[model samples]
Target: MTREIENAAGIPVVQIATIVPIMLTVGANRIVPGVAIPHPTGSPELGKAGDKATRRELLLRAFKAMETEITYQTVFE
Candidate 1:
């Protein structure tokens, strides 16, 4: 898996997924809560501006998560 490879390579990975619980179950260390499965970064119902803002926020969270060091799995909302 990609996560496994990243972990083996010592790469700080930020995974974005609609199902945070599932990602956690699978041992994902850094996770960004996504809008949905179909649109992980943006939502169609939120319109252009809202979707863009949401994506930006998620990306920012991911960046922060990447910067922080953790011994266990972490989920960024």
Candidate 2:
């Protein structure tokens, strides 16, 4: 689906998922390692402020992944 969106629509995609191996196996070109399965961006245990910070960091990484040029599948861990 990611490849199809990129290929057919000409839009770069960054996939944020906890199951990195599965995304890679499925041929996701740009992947970001999510924090957890339930909460893929922020950790609830970190409290409000910390969770916000973590989420920000994850978003930044995802943006970076979208900006990067790659010939094959890559993980922004």
Candidate 3:
């Protein structure tokens, strides 16, 4: 993982609450709040019609956000 990100410039690695606090304390740039433990994409219970639609929208938005070139903080909330 470290080898792959050697040329990533200023990438910020984050985990759940444990690593999240540490990352934030160190002033890292990005933190992606994962959806779940075993399944990050989603689950069937929360993937009902409406939920799936919302998830799809969120994914699309995340993808679109990758196009932006800003250097500030942003949250999906």
Candidate 4:
């Protein structure tokens, strides 16, 4: 709903969700695949270093997604 509103208001929004498939089904145009439902940014079990890397990767993908143009729902892995 937030995404829809933002888009409607001419605000380009990037959605980060653990469930990429579901977001795609709901017609989200820009999405970043989250690490998990509980820890969408990083996983505690991955240790500090690994968790930081995962978070960095997601952030990079999100920035890339924002720069890229798309006609349909797109997910950055």
Candidate 5:
């Protein structure tokens, strides 16, 4: 059987999640999540180049999930 959320029907969509560094290391740096490479979200050092790039692009896409039309699984290898 498929999984189900409590209010899944009512909830449209929002946010994306990934395996973090593992994904990046596995050629999945393109996926978005609550955090990013080297440093996940909530890190105090969001001023570096890599950190900033991950934060801007990675983070932005995660937020974009909130406006997505439907709830679908987007898995990565």
Candidate 6:
């Protein structure tokens, strides 16, 4: 879906995925490695404040990835 959206709509997208290799195999151009499979943005081990911070960091990374220009698939590790 992400690939289709980017190619068909001519829009940039950053995919936040736990399994980075799979997303890369599927040709996801921009990827931010997620925290975990079940909790991609927020960690269950952390409290509310920590979770918020984690999510915020992920969002910031995504924004950074979106602003970057790449000729091929790129991972914002």
Best by TM-score: 6
lDDT by residue for model 4 (1-77), tens: 84677568876578888988888787778899887899999978989999999888888888898898887777776
Which scores higher on lDDT, 2 or 4?
2
Candidate 2, poorest ten consecutive residues by summed lDDT? 2-11
Better-scoring candidate (TM-score), 5 or 6: 6
lDDT of 1 by residue, 1-77 (tens): 64796779989889999888898888788988898899999977989999999888989999999999888888776
Across 1-77, the per-residue lDDT of candidate 6 in tens digits comes to 88999999898889998998899899889999999999999976899999999999999999999999889888887
- Per-candidate TM-score against the hidden true structure: 0.88, 0.92, 0.44, 0.83, 0.39, 0.95
What are the per-residue Cα lDDT tens digits for candidate 2 across 1-77?
88788889887899888999999898889999998999998989999999999999999999999999888899888
Q: For all candidates, what are the clash counts?
A: 0, 0, 0, 0, 1, 0
5 or 6: which has the higher lDDT?
6
Task: Report the C-alpha displacement of residue 67, candidate 4, in angstroms.
Answer: 0.5
> Model 4: residues >4 Å from true position, as ranges?
none
Screening candidate 4 with a backbone cut-off below 3 angstroms (N, C-alpha, C), the clashing residue pairs are: none
The candidates, ranked best first by TM-score, are: 6, 2, 1, 4, 3, 5
Poorly placed runs, candidate 2 (over 4 Å) = none
- Give the C-alpha lDDT of model 4: 0.82
Using lDDT, give the best candidate's number: 6
Candidate 3 residue-wise lDDT at 35? 55
Q: Model 3 off-target regions past 4 Å? A: 2-31, 72-75
Error of 4 at 61 (Å): 0.4
Candidate 3 root-mean-square deviation in Å: 5.0
Ranking by lDDT: 6, 2, 1, 4, 3, 5
Model 5 lDDT tens row, 1-77: 01223144544233234454554454332335654334455344655775667556655665564444433443322
Better of 1 and 2 by TM-score: 2
